[model samples]
Each structure stands twice: as C-alpha cells, then as structure tokens.
Target: MTKSKQTEWNFDNTYARLPKSFFSDTNPTPVNSPELAIFNDQLAESLGLNAEALNTEDGAAMFAGNEIPEGASPLAQAYAGHQFGHFTMLGDGRAVLLGEQISPKDERFDIQLKGSGRTPFSRGGDGRAALGPMLREYIISEAMHALGIPTTRSLAVVTTGEPVIRETELPGAILTRVAASHLRVGTFEYAARLGNVEELQVLADYAIKRHYPDIEDNEDRYLSLLEEVIKRQAELIAKWQLVGFIHGVMNTDNVTISGETIDYGPCAFMDTYDPETVFSSIDVQGRYAYGNQPLIGGWNLARFAETLLPLLHENQDHAVELAQEKISDFSNLYQSHWLKGMRAKLGLFNEEKEDEALINDLLSMMKEHRADYTNTFRALTFEKHDDTALFGIPEFTQWHERWHVRLSRQQESKDSVNQLMQNSNPAVIPRNHRVEEALEAAVENGDYSVLGKLLDVLSKPYAHSAEQEEYCAVPKSAAPYQTFCGT
Candidate 1:
C-alpha cells in the first residue's frame, strides 16, 4: 500500500516487508482523549526524529493509537516462549510494532507501542496497561541506558483518559518503546513450531542481517550467530550483576537476540549485597534472583540453540553436541566478564592470581554485614574513611586490609585506582524506594517533577554530585521489598 510520508517519524518499515506469517497485521486500539504523559526529547533526536514538531498533542495521539503515523504499519509479532521453564505459546499480547525507524546515523530501531491494545495473542484478558507500570518502565529503562547497559529505550508514555480495571480502577497509559530489534529467543521457538527449516532459516537470516551482519558471509553463520548471541548475553548478564540489577523475569520470550534488555516487568536494583535477593513476587522459586541471572541466561540461550538445531546441522545428534559445547563455554565467558568488571569496581588495575579470591572474600563480608551494595562500592571508589557502618565491621576491615595490599601491589598511582573505580562503579542507581516514590508522585499526585529529577540524576550515574547522594540513600526499612509484574 502506498502511504504519505511522516517527516518526524522517518520510518523504513523493513519488518513489515517480511513474510506475513511472521506477524499479525494489527492496529492499536484507540483510546479516549489521549494526553501526553512524558516524552524523551533527547532520545527522539538521537533516533533521528523531528522532536519539536511531534512534541505536542499530535504526538500523544500517535502514541495512544488515536492517529497512526503515516509510515507506520502496525502489527503484532508472533512468538512462543518458555515461561519459568514451562514451554508455552505467547506473543505480543498488548503491543504493536509500528515499524523500524532509521536514524540519521544509519542506526535502525524498532519502534513499538506497548500496552497499545490486545491482539490475537492477548489470551483472555483486557489488552490494556496501567499508567504506573508504564511510567515505571520508562524510568527504569532510561536509567538502564544511563548506566551504560544495553536495554530497550522508552520514547514516550501517553496517558489514556480512561480507567483500566485491574484489582481496582487505575489510570491507563501506553509506552512507545524503541529497541535495536524485538527478535527474541521466543521468536525462534515460535518459528520452529511451524515445522520447516526454511521458515527458521528466513527468520535467522533476517536477524543476522539486522543485528550481526558481520557474520553473514561466514561458512557457518548459524552457529556463529548462536556463539555471538551467547557471548553478548554472557557479557550482558555480567554487567547486570555488577550493577545489582535484577531482571526478575528471565523467560526465553524476554531474552532478546540483540542482547538488549527487553521487558522490565518486576525488575529492580538490589539494595544490600546478598546473592539470594529476589524481588519478583512471582519468582517463588528464586529462579531469576540476583545470583541466578547468569545461569538463567545460559538456560535461555540453550532454548534458543534448540530452536536453531536444524539450521546448525543436518545430523540431529551432531547439532546437539555442537550446541552443548557452545553452551558449556557460557560459564567461562560469564565468569571472565564478571571478574573483569569486578576488578574494575575494586580498582584493581593489575590482575593478581588471588584477585578472584579477594573479590569473593569482600563479597562474602558484605553479605555477612548486610552492607548496601552501591554505597559500599561508592565508598571504596572514594577510599573514604567515614563509612563506619561498613568499614567498622571486623571481617570487612580485614578484607579491606587485603584489598589495600592488593592495591598496593599495583604499579599504578592512587589517582589511577580511584579513577578506575569511579568510572566502573556508579555514584547513583534507580534505587527501589526512589523509583517507587517517583511513580507514586506521578501516578497519584500528578507530580512529574519528582520523576524528572530522578531521571536527571540517573543520566549521569558515574559522576558524583551532592544532589545524587539523596538518591543513593538506601530505603529506611529493612522489610522484604517485593515487586509484581505489570500484567
């Protein structure tokens, strides 16, 4: 179909050009009297959008599905996933991919309207989303970007002038999410269900061209793609652990092929340095806990490999052996990445044979002392002496001495040590209390200033500011913090 050009959108919808079987041609359900909730102006410009022109009511209308953009071909992607280890059929239930937006710098991104409405995959519930959860995603995703983590970006959130009936009535909102691409492990799983290697090959080719174009000419591009994805995920999960970010839900569907964090449901940053911490109320098994992320990452990759078996090799047993070897390498890759990151966090400019033990010993002390994770790192970054709460512990003091000796062995100057730590460790994070406070103010009081300020601090996570210290403060209560999925 011929379409008019939208100057601001600049959409080049390659995803829609794919086979129709890959997605359902669907449009977002229109909402009543849509209003602009929030817009990421900086992100808009970076995405090569004409931010000024679309920063008004028209933008809200576009995001709220009241007015589809000229270049947009709204559709819901089809995918299946293993939810908490249980295989199930699922897809975009309340979201629609508008199209891929090509930026001026030649970067391609998938622009999607999440919580737009229901589709063929909505299952049996209202395909609507509440404002609070949408705002939470906006805040956390932006925070993740600032923390230098690969994640889906939030372009805008528009409030629908209607109440969504959850347990009780709640204000509705829609999130315009931008991503490297929405191709996930679940997509492969869904394609495998079609019972054809050609179908899977097409999807694999599309993904490789979009994300891993470098590997296209390889003799074994399929296996190479799997290895590349596995490595990306290993590095990605290590970064998550370093920053105390718990994804809460690590189901195969949520695992993106681009290694970018996708869904933000029930996600939060840890407070104290405890390996057993789990905030997702639904994660009763502690499957995706702070310590279990790397394992879950490997598990998810194995699922992805299973879908690619036919493409990997003609002999099923040989393919299994190849996939297993690759999966086995995940642990070493993850450990190497995590250890390297931990070294930077510790200001260890040079590697020591005992570095792993040193890092583990400190972590053990932190857990035993119930010390705040971010603050302890920040204090160590500054080499501050005022943190009696953590430094006062005898076990920690001994650990500090060992770390001091370790630092002493390095030829680098003290300034170098501090610089490395400052660069590696964030001065601020999207602390749970702070996030909740911002969401509460915006959703209940209609006060966005709280949220804006939090974003401002989060934007410069490494640079220390006196104002950032407020956000760095841990929640007063030691009560078990809980997180619930938006759905």
Candidate 2:
C-alpha cells in the first residue's frame, strides 16, 4: 500500500503537528472497485482543484481510498460526546481526514472521506457508509449552502463496488466532505477529561489562531472564545428555527466551534408547523425535538464552557462565575436573532414593541390549524389573502386583519415588505418525502434524474413559481415520519 505522489491538492498539515493524542494516523481502506458517481465542479473550482483531473479513473481511485494523494497525512480524529444525555468516547469510526488543503483564496478546509473505511474507533462494527445516506448528505448539505446556511459542503461522492450490511445489504459509497475546520466542542472535552491542562491550553490556542485570530492577543482569550462560540451557536440555532430545520442530533461532537453545521445524519426540514416535532427515530424521548433546539444549544455550550474552565481563569470559582454569566446571555441573543428573522418572514420591515406578540400569534394559529410551515410564510408574499388557501381559516382571516392593520402603521412600502418576506421565506426545501424517493430511486434502481430534478428546484429556494409548486406540497403519508442515523 504505497502512497501515490501525484495530486492536484495543495496540502497544509497543521493539525497533524498537534499532539499525537489528538488523532490516529491512518489511511483510508481501499474499496474492491471504485467509480466516481458525482463531482461538484463548481465547488472544485472554488477550492482551486482541477475538476477535469478528478473526473477521471485516477481521480476515482484517489477518492475511493485505493490511492493516497501526495502530501496527505490521513488520520482519525479523537473526540467525546454526550449522546442522548449519556457521555461516551467517540472518534472517526467510519471517516478519515486526508489533511487540510489551502484554497487559492488562502482559506483552509479539511478534506475528509466519510464511509471511507474502518478505523481504530470502529467499535466492533463495519465502518462503511451506504450509498443512500452518502447521497442524502450530498443533496441536503448542498441545498443548505444554497439556502444561505453555514454548512459543510460535499466535493465528490464515489461508489464502492461492494456491499454494506445495514438493515440489509446496501451498496457502499464514499463522500468527500469539505469544512472550514473539524474542531468541535468535544475535542476540548476529551483533552480536559485526560486532566492535561497543557494539552488543553495548546488546543485552545490552536483553536483561537485557526478560527478566531482576532482574539489571540486578548488576555481573556479563553473566556472570549467561549462567549464567541455561544453567540455563534445561538444565531445558528435561530437560523435553523427560522428555516424549520430539525438537526435531530445536537450532541456536543456534532456542534462545531467553527459555527458551521456538521454531520447531516437524521436531519430534516419541517413540512408542517409543530413546535414539538421530532423526526429522528432513535429519539424516543424527543430530547432533540424542534422546539428544544435552543435550550439544547445552550446546554451543549455549557459543556463546552466546562472544558475551558481551567484556562478561563486562574481562580476556579471566578471562572465558573464568568462562564455562567456568558451562558445566561444566550437566551437574549437567540431571542433577538429569532425575532429579527420571524419579523422579516411576516413582511414587517420596521420593528415594533407588539411585533413579538404579532408573530407568535400567527405561529400559534398555524400550529393550531396544522398549516404548512414553508407555505404559510411563502403565502404572506401574495397580495390577496384568499389567493393563499392555507390561510383560509376564520382564525387566520381574523389574524390577517390584525396583520394588515399592523402593516399599515409601518412607513415602509408594501412592495418592499413583500420583497422582504419573499426573500426570507423559501419556496422549496429538501422535502423529506422527496428526499426519500430520490434516495430510493438512485440506490435501488440507479435512476438519478429524479435526484437531479430535486436538486435543481432546491438550488433556487427563494424563487416562487408555478413550475415548482408541486415541490411546495407536504407528503400525505398516513404513518408518522421518521429518519434513521444510517450508522
């Protein structure tokens, strides 16, 4: 298994220079046969990668783990997470980082392969990813990027001419994920649990330099890092709530210090408005329900803050007090972001004291009537109330009058407000049913047209048109919807 010396990637292995305990050096397991299934040409160009070079057989080999590119020091990162209220040691069981690539614009990104192969952290299971879930992540993550959400993007997907046994035997696949950095809250937790203050301090400084270089000179940089992470997570969750997205797993490891959304397992967008909605089948207790995301975000940040206590202050009690005060600000920060986004959705350009109640009342009515979350907001862009049938209810009609009165008091023009709502509310999301159908067709029948069609519609999320009207409808399934983690 000799490494190949040819590659189009510009590698900078900074993380590899960290302590040996931070990661396990390894190469991706070679698949029996490899074929390139999808390549993001646009993303490739942005990363300064030669897309033409990667679309060939040799490129497929590089992506499928048959050949390690030159300058790649592949490794499995170590982490620990509180999954479903239970803390456990975790790592890159089925994935491997191929080293960092500095883009043409001087931005750094980790090029990792998901479903590449087994690692030391496989934990008695086959560390393989099925084709369906890999493609699912490819579709949803790109869609999220198009919708203006900060998220990890897919560079390519390669199919392995092998089978993985899940609930049944499924075709194996590999996904190349690009991220700003792979630093997570759980990384710090792992260091703290080892009782190595030196390691923790080194990791903290590395994080600040990598992600928050502006705070490197500050004396209270550790405290500032904690505060910045909290603010980012709060705003991230606020955006998720505004878009009706359910992460389904808000565990510590899945929470990135970079503020980018990572790990797209068992994630879905809301079809209908229900504050307590839970989509992950494994979540029997609804611990990560839609309504609880903000609280869970704060809770995860609290865990992150705990790990920084040794570095936050010399006095332990003083550090705890500082952390608590910062954590307390999460609620107000989240509320401000949420209110701003919700107000724009309601076509309100100017803020008013009554805006909160007005927005909440509309959501309450929508929940009471089980209105479609995306459509209900999209409907507000229309001039005639009757044109949007979802608001045909008497309660909505009454609320509509109040909304109109509220709008009249504002000085902004109606056209400008309508434009604001149309921009804030997306007409198309990666609908759960549609996503399932696409995955089934591609994985079961090798039909990719449906998947391409869905991607085309989702790429223009803000564009409301008759052609994409069907995409706006919710599925009429009788059974409750559920999504699996595809472990």
Candidate 3:
C-alpha cells in the first residue's frame, strides 16, 4: 500500500464519527495504473487545496485511490432509496467519501471519489466507472455551477488504466467529487428502516448541525428542517425548469438534503422546448420528464417527510397531518419560485395577475413552433426590430404585441429590462449533442481539445460571444434524445 500522500487537503472526517451503522469504513480499491486526466485548479483553490501539490503524480495517486490523503477516513455511506417509485436498498455501490475538507474560512465540504472501486454496497455489479461518463459529469456539473445553479463541483478525473464491462469493455476512470454534504433524503429513510428512533434522531441532529445550523436549537427543529429542505428543493426544481435542465432520474437517494443537485448520471438540458422531454433511457414512462420535475420533487419530499414521522410528534395521526401540511406547501412554493424566474426571463419586474399568462403564452408558442429554449429567450434580448424575422410568426407576433403593451406599464428603463433578461437567459447550455460530441472525441480519439473549448464557452453561460455561436444552436432533429445512467 502506498503511504499517505502529503497533499494539501485539510481532511476532517466528521461523518466518520457517526454510529458505525451509518457507514462502512473502507478504503477505495486501488487500480493498476493511475494517470491524471483533468484537474480543476480553481475548485482546488476554493477548497483551500494546494494546486501545485494536486497537479503532480502524487495527486494522481491520491485521487485514483492508490494512496489515501492524510487525515482521511474513506467510507461507503449506507442509505436506501426509491428507484423509479419502487423502494429498494442502495448505498455507495461505486463510490467512497474521502472525508471532508475545511477551508480557511471554515466552510466544510466533502471530497468523494466516484468510480473509484467497489465497496460493501457494490451488490452484484462491477463498481467501475467509464471515462466517457466521468468526463460527461465533469463537463455538465461545471457548466451547472457556472450557470449559477447549486451543484456538486468536479475536482479531478483520473484514468484507471483498466477496462470495465458494460455493453462492452470501456476505459475505466475515477471522478473526484466535492459537495456540501452527501446526507440525503434516503439516508434518513435508511435510519428509519433500521427501526431505531435514537439513530434517526442522531442522523437528524447531525444533519441540522452540518447543513442547517441556524435551527439546531429550535424546539421543533425537526419540523423546521423538513420545511427548510422543502423550500430549497422547491427553488431548486424551479431553477432547473428555468434553465431547461432534466435530472433524468429523480430517485429518492439522489435528492440531497442540502438541496444541491447531485448524481449527474443521465442528466441533460433540453435543446428545444417540449414538456414531454425525457433523456434518461431507463425512464421509459417519463416519470421525470422536463415538465414533471416539480411534481417528482414533491413526491421525493413526501418520502423524506415519511421518514421523519417517528420524530414529528407523539401521535401518529397528528404527525401524518403535520407532514401532509408541509408536503402540501410544495406546489404553491414551487409555482411562486418558478413564476418569479419566468418573470425575470421575460424582463417583468412588477407582478400582475396577467404576468403569468403572458409568460405561459410565450412558452406555449415556443413549444408549438419547436423553438430553441435557450436561443428563443436569448433572441428576445436583441433589438426587436432587427430580429423581427425570428419572432415574426403569427402567434409570436400577437404575443409580442401584448408583451409590448405590458412593458409600457413598467417603470424600468428598456435597457434595464433588457439587461435583466440577458442575465436571466443564458447564452450557452450543455447541449446534449455538443456534450456527446466532446465525450466521443475524448473517449474514442484521445482528443481533449473539444472538451476544453466547450468548458471555456460554458464558463461564461450568460455572456455573448459571436465566435461561440455554434454552441448555441439547438439539435436539428426533434427525435427523442436519450441519456444513459452509466452504471
């Protein structure tokens, strides 16, 4: 075994101090040959990591599971989740948390290795990850962060110099994942299933201290915690809808209690407007389609609320009533957040009853005309007279007339409204076709230039660049695009 690599990760294994049943202490299984594929220098700096140390061979070893960083206690967390509406036990089958890091400013973050190797939760499959999927996550997750969405950031990707069998053998890789915390709705479910009320309380208290410290002392902190999670998830799904993001899989385990986007398995952003759009190949029923995210988010939160019943109150019926009341808030909360975002996209600062109808009217037209979601919104920012051709359709023209009358009532200057629209509407998103092209080039041809260029363009998703216009174009075909959950 390699000695602990002297890297600059300020490891703090707080989760490890929890009860033994919470996680299994296991080191990441080392690979044959490890090579550094990509390093996120900026992310490393934010984590108070020594960028110079992490870009070296030792860093590759550390990231690849060949050497544990100092002060680390690698473990596979225990959790059960509802996969596709079916309850099942699942855990870190292919990943391990390499402890947490406390930055100079005292912010704590988890450092995890995905696709590192098998663990106690590996079940019956090979716990190996492919290079293409790993790179895909790096690209998409970073793009999400740059687009001002909450998400787990990618720190590095390392080639394992081995092959893993899926449809066929593919190059193995490991992804270094950084997050606020890996505690999920499923984790609470896991504690509940153990039939230990004390354990459930422990997990809830720990979660509150780690994520929602403000309410730790409240008498009804557990209820407050549930409410807080509901709020974050509501706003999160709203943001995803505004940005045309599809999570592909809305499994309970994937819903983080901290409310950051987790598990970029089969996730994708829509190239065109369609309420029925689904990218996950496993989602044949479209349970998590583009338009169904808010609903699914509510469903998942209900599941989370179920696990908290034992701690909610003394009477089971009262607890159920309280939980249902909290869960019922999801729809209205989500709509309010979603409408606010939609208003910003349309450059409306003041809210009127008709504002929602105007926004929906535009969306309805976009769907009917098969308009590019990102581009259509972006096009609205340009001088309307100069690009009247794009919006010249009869339905859009009628809607534009109404929009102008609505705008005339606003007090904000035209330039200010345009600026707000530009900020709300992104110029670039991780289009499925473009992302696939970059992944294929790197996986098949060993060329990373494509990936680098895409990252550069995505890093400034709100900025306009004439040279990067090609990145803004939607897919040519309307055929259903599918994404795989690279298991």
Q: Which stretches of candidate 1 lie over 4 Å from their true place?
A: 1-7
Q: What is the TM-score of each candidate against the true structure?
A: 0.98, 0.97, 0.97
- lDDT, candidate 3, equals 0.91
Q: lDDT value for candidate 1? A: 0.90
Lowest-lDDT window of 10 residues in candidate 1?
A: 1-10
Candidate 1 on 1-487: residue-level lDDT in tens? 2112433677778878777778999999999989988999999989877677667787788889888888788999999999999999898999999998988898999999998888998999678899999999999999999989999999999999988887789999999999999999999999998887788899999999999999999999999999999999999999999999999999999999999998998999998999999999999999999998998899999999999999999999999999999999999999999999999999987787899999888888788878888898898888784552577777777888888988899899999888989999999999999999999999999999999999999999999889887887887797888988888
Q: Candidate 2 at residue 82, lDDT?
A: 90
RMSD of 2: 1.9
Could you give me the TM-score of model 3 versus the true structure? 0.97
Model 3 C-alpha lDDT per residue in residues 1-487, reported as the tens digit of each score: 3333345678889999999999999889999999888899999988888888889888999999998888899999999999999988889999999999998789999999999888999999688899999999999999999988899999999999999999989999999999999999999989999999999999999999999999999999999999999999999999999999999999999999998999999999987789999889999999999999999999999999999999999899999999999999999999999999998998999999999889888888878877778888888877543232336677777888899899889999999999999899998999899999999999999889999999999999988778668997766676777889999
| TM-score-sorted candidate list, best first | 1, 3, 2
After superposing candidate 3 on the true structure, give the runs of residues whose Cα lies further than 4 Å from its correct spot.
Answer: 1-6, 384-390
Tens digit per residue, CA lDDT, model 2, 276-331: 99999899999999999999999999999999999988899999999999999999
